[model samples]
Target: MVNINEIARLAGVSRTTVSRALNQSGYVSEKARKKITKVIEETGYVPSEQAKSLRLQRTKVIGVVLPKISTETLGRIVEGIDEILSASGYQILLANSSLNKEKEIAQLKLLESRRVDGIILAATNREETLMQTIRELRVPLIAVGQDLPEVSSVIYDDFNAAKTIMKKMISKGYRRIGFIGVEETDQAVGQFRKQAYLDVMNEENIEIQEGWMQQADFNIQSGEASMEAMLQVCSTRPEAVFAVTDRLAVGAMQTIRKRGLRVPEEIGIAGIGASEISRYVTPPLTTIDYQYEEAGRESARLLLEQLESGKKSVKKSVMNYGLLERDSLI
Candidate 1:
């Protein structure tokens, strides 16, 4: 509860001098600044965050809006963001939008109202309304994982990554390959991965079987249900299934085991998003390592750069992805 007044009284300096020192203003003498700082620290004099923000017109806080807060990929991304922001003396404010456009827009406005210095958004899909709002906002905005054409973004080459995995599977002599993904509205899970699969299959002259392709909500339960549906519908079940995420692959694996099928011997399963659990699963998952943490760190760096430079140049940064082969596929 110690305020600047007590520090001022102890330092025998005027309130103006105390304010200048605390704000790191050039008006304060170096010797006086040190003395005031020592007194403030010794007394534990905490300045009013609201007052400081008002005076400086900067909060030194970054808002991170994640599409799905509970996902493992998002968790690691946030950890990376926190590491970078903490080192830079900036705090993080988190908002979970659950892939809802309305909620995301509301959270953006809330962050703006709180005077956040910048925002890093892990968007669900490209929404024109949300993009327009972000463009009109005063704070620096950086998109992560998904991109807005007019904004700065740090994203993985999702389409190419998926294509690489499909081609690898095909080369390994896996002809009956299935694709389990989220709703097509989700650009990352649907458009990117699904389109890549189709393109690869068509180029390889593989027939497109309706039953081998399924879309769900990108959760374990949805994955399980999708796999079961595929098994029921497909006359010739897929020899390998490529899930859009690790969670989905794990779920599909479980379903396969329950059906008395041995992995790789009977069915092979792989997925995107090389989460931690992917490496620890029973047979270990063969998937693409998207470098979620690197993406997060880069997103933070881009936002910080914009905040410091006061420039709005459109930047598109695509990080590399590695295909991690484990016991599950080979």
Candidate 2:
């Protein structure tokens, strides 16, 4: 593609003069305009719509970065975002990081290069490099799932949600409870949720066995492996388990059933993220509903406010959650 720089070089004029000649919005000498026109005619250089939008400083597009694209939770969130953004005549440009920290930062920079009106990131980890990159963005940005410093965020009450579920589990007279979580780099799902479980267990005066707490990745296979490792290493088996995500919980259930254990009878299990498949499992899974769609809508709404008002204002929205009591944790 013949860009304005090439056009400028061919025309013996600056890029700014070429832009001025193309848009006719600024003063351009007749000699320079003729030179640019001759270059355009020779090279067949028609300016792209993206170039025009960049000149005008309005693309009417929002960049959305996700940790993974296949999850139902993220799908619902995108649905909500599209619901609001489409009404405002803005389109979404989606980029998936696939849960890689480096890829997350790279995608953010790529979106910025695209010159989208704004960006909404469903962030996983709050690493310093990622946070610094967010701080340096030239466009308005909103973060989902993690509370980033000085940045507008839409987050779930992860600590309270986990604590509430744990308290309920304790109320059922289950002292030997296990936990499956991700790395603490992810502030919402990993650190806050794990801390809530620890607090609840400490408050109830329950002893957490050495192998009772295990870390796993976001996938079901990792959940199964983590659970199996827990069972192998622990001298005393836990009566129940709390997984940080529904997929992980489902994986744990698979491992338990494979060992001829009955759910909620031999081993009770629950997870966060109220995924659709959680309901249809042989024994329904109990999980927390984080209102994923609502988070998306709210984040979009805030970004629109910044765009419309031409102001970058910092705001924090803590989304509500609910515990769905089901057969798994009965």
Clashes of each: 0, 0
Any idea how many clashes model 2 has?
A: 0
Compared with the true structure, what per-residue lDDT tens digits does model 1 show for residues 222-255? 8899899999999999999999899999999989
Local lDDT at 281 for model 2: 90
In model 1, where is the ten-residue run with the lowest total lDDT?
47-56
Best by TM-score: 2
Candidate-wise lDDT, in order: 0.85, 0.90
lDDT of 1: 0.85
- Give all candidate RMSDs, comma-separated: 6.2, 5.7
- Stretches off by above 4 angstroms in model 2 are 1-55
Model 2 lDDT per residue over 177-275, tens place = 999999999999999999999999999888898999999999999999999998999999999999999999999999999988989899999999999
Query: Candidate 1 at residue 229, lDDT?
Result: 93
